[model samples]
Target: MKRTTLSIALLSTVMLLTGCGEESNQTSNTATTQSVEKEPAQKACYDVGETTSFERKDVTGPRCQWRSEHNFIVYSEDLSKPEYPGTLPVKPGYAVRRAKEWPREDLSDASSYDKPRIQFWWNNVSSRDPLVNDYENGYKIWSVKIDGTDLRLVTDDMPSTASPQTFMMSRSPNNRYVAYAYSYGEPLIKAIFDLKTQQTIQLGSARTKPYLVWADDSSYIYFSDGFKRYKYTLATGIKEEVDVPLSENTVIVDGKLINAAGLGVGVYDAKTLKRLYTILPEKEFEDSVDIEKRIYRQIAISPNGKYVWGINSYRKVLINVEDKTWLAFSKEGDEKKVYDKVVNISNNGRETQVGAAIITIKHYGSDYRYELTGKGRQSWKVIQSGQNTITPVLYNADANDGRFLEIENDE
Candidate 1:
């Protein structure tokens, strides 16, 4: 059955390929005339330069060269951290607690691994935008070891052209390949850099702005070209358009594509191109308040893909995919029903706790500060709070089961 399915897919791909050239140029010229103009084949990767060696002292910033033998995890410290210049640090098991200072200059980008030592990328300077000037004076790639030793630069030579705007880079799941996008105004180009061979291949001109999400190590790469979701096979060089149109943020789970698009979230089958299920947004909550006046933003997805975590109307919510149930944490009501800004649920969904920050409200020319009652043996506590941002980092199984851990302020 798998072989038969494969045969049908191949046949369908051939038909699509026959019309791609005409389809790509439909706006520029008529289909008949455009048929003669062929679209270039996708290259396997993109090349910037050869890998060379450089010491940390040679770069402008303090300790500018770094590389990691293991896959490294990249995260941003500030939520408002700009699109670039955010440092990707190797998640060391032991925490390095020090006075707040600039991140290492040499390690700019990094990948995540499960165990042992992970790898990270560094910039020569502490600027938020590292690659903005890489093409001007040339940029270097460095490798850092797990123990924070053997930091060295490795890149052949820099490109002649200025670094393209919106240069985004991500390592493949297997850590064998690094993919990046070179934004050229309207049309964006994607390229994959082979870490083992030190070579690059351009994926060809993207139809729309391309954002990449990898499926796995071997078969296919999932990338969205604005409106449509496509899977480009590295082995066959074939691109297949899926039925589902993906949003900017997409999550791959159990070989499925899950994304929030238009009224609900969709679970799509990557192989067969079918939507298995859709979880519509809860209208009850939206109708309770004027949704038009609120701003909704998605933050993170759980590793298991069972919950969708997001902030709506400055309040955090956890939406369960299985039941389509909405759990909200807010600071506006009674103890039994109302909550502040922080809420946590156990993995089994059995235990839950809600935390909130105390806020002062001025009404009728009077300043009123609301606080939680039933402090000793009952529910909820003010874990963390401030004027700007309130973050409840941890919650216990019961009201008094565990104390609110900490509240982080984002000012």
Candidate 2:
């Protein structure tokens, strides 16, 4: 069945009415209870099977489907590689949308920085099968430089699955190891791959596809299989059962886990798994609507780890990790404008303030870019506009030069 698309404003209005809200800089000592309601049956996802002619008016199907796997084209920005302006022509048949973070330009070692590498998932389909077949085939982790040289396979252990959407892969911060899993309908397998050692350490299978997160220091890996949490230490080669603030929808930054706890949000010590504080919606959302919308279902953390943002269907909250302050916004225009991503960039324009960092905000539709600094938010010009699912590569805050990898859904 075709996926349904809702306007951002309409979706935000629905979310604001049925979901919790967070604003200002206040936080709570504990989490509050808020019941969440599912969208009306008319908006739910359901299989239309071979009958593709029927429209939504005649069917009460799902608002969304289980997965919407699509082809991903690679793109990059490197002054050394002028060949890659829009899309980097990769040999892989299909690429995963989750492109691991590219390393910042290392002024110390200009050689390595000039040849930045990007790791992503690519399908290794068999020659016998149709080249453009569905995902129920094979996948392998691979990496290539911005100029398309040094193409190497990260791993080939990914299981053949009908549902590539269920697979999860995470690259460590230090760029040494990759934690990957094939969840499928049930938990199948999970493991860690050492890029240097070229060794695969199986972390054991999960009853469900487990969530994988790496510590800020790259010392340990935390994962939860819905029932219990486990921490895997890298140096000791030890896997121990431990309680962590890990959840299906949590991101760890600066040794802290930003957890989406029902209608509210929580910050916890990633190492100790102890709750540091709880962020609750303002009185307006908490008392106004008791229903939930799975607040903060998605999280994006800045490279510097100083800022993190949580996004639900339409509402989003940006939190300043160091100050413990936050700002809430939605697409409805009642609050601050919602931004989908936040990244740190050096303010090169001001040579005296070279050390100063500028926060770049990429809007949801990839239509506009904005820079948020201590003063306020302002427009940041960018070349790639009117395109959706555009991931920045070597993203420059000045808007003078940058590379964007665009993912177009192939129907």
Q: Candidate 1, 55: how far from true, in Å? A: 25
Candidate 1: what lDDT? 0.40
Global fold similarity of model 1 (TM-score)? 0.45
Per-candidate TM-score against the hidden true structure: 0.45, 0.52
lDDT of each: 0.40, 0.45
Best by lDDT: 2
lDDT of 1 by residue, 1-411 (tens): 999999999999999997896777775677577689887742211111211223211221221212222112122123222221211222121111110121331323433221112222222321222222433233223333322223233332334232332323444555555555545445666666665576776665555666666664435666665566667777787888765555434556577777753344678786675888886554555767676534354343332345555555545455676676656655344422332222333222322233222211111101112222221112211111011112221211122222121112201
lDDT of 2 by residue, 254-305 (tens): 6677765454557888667788887665335655554555455655444334
For all candidates, the clash counts are 31, 8
Instruction: lDDT for model 2, please.
Output: 0.45
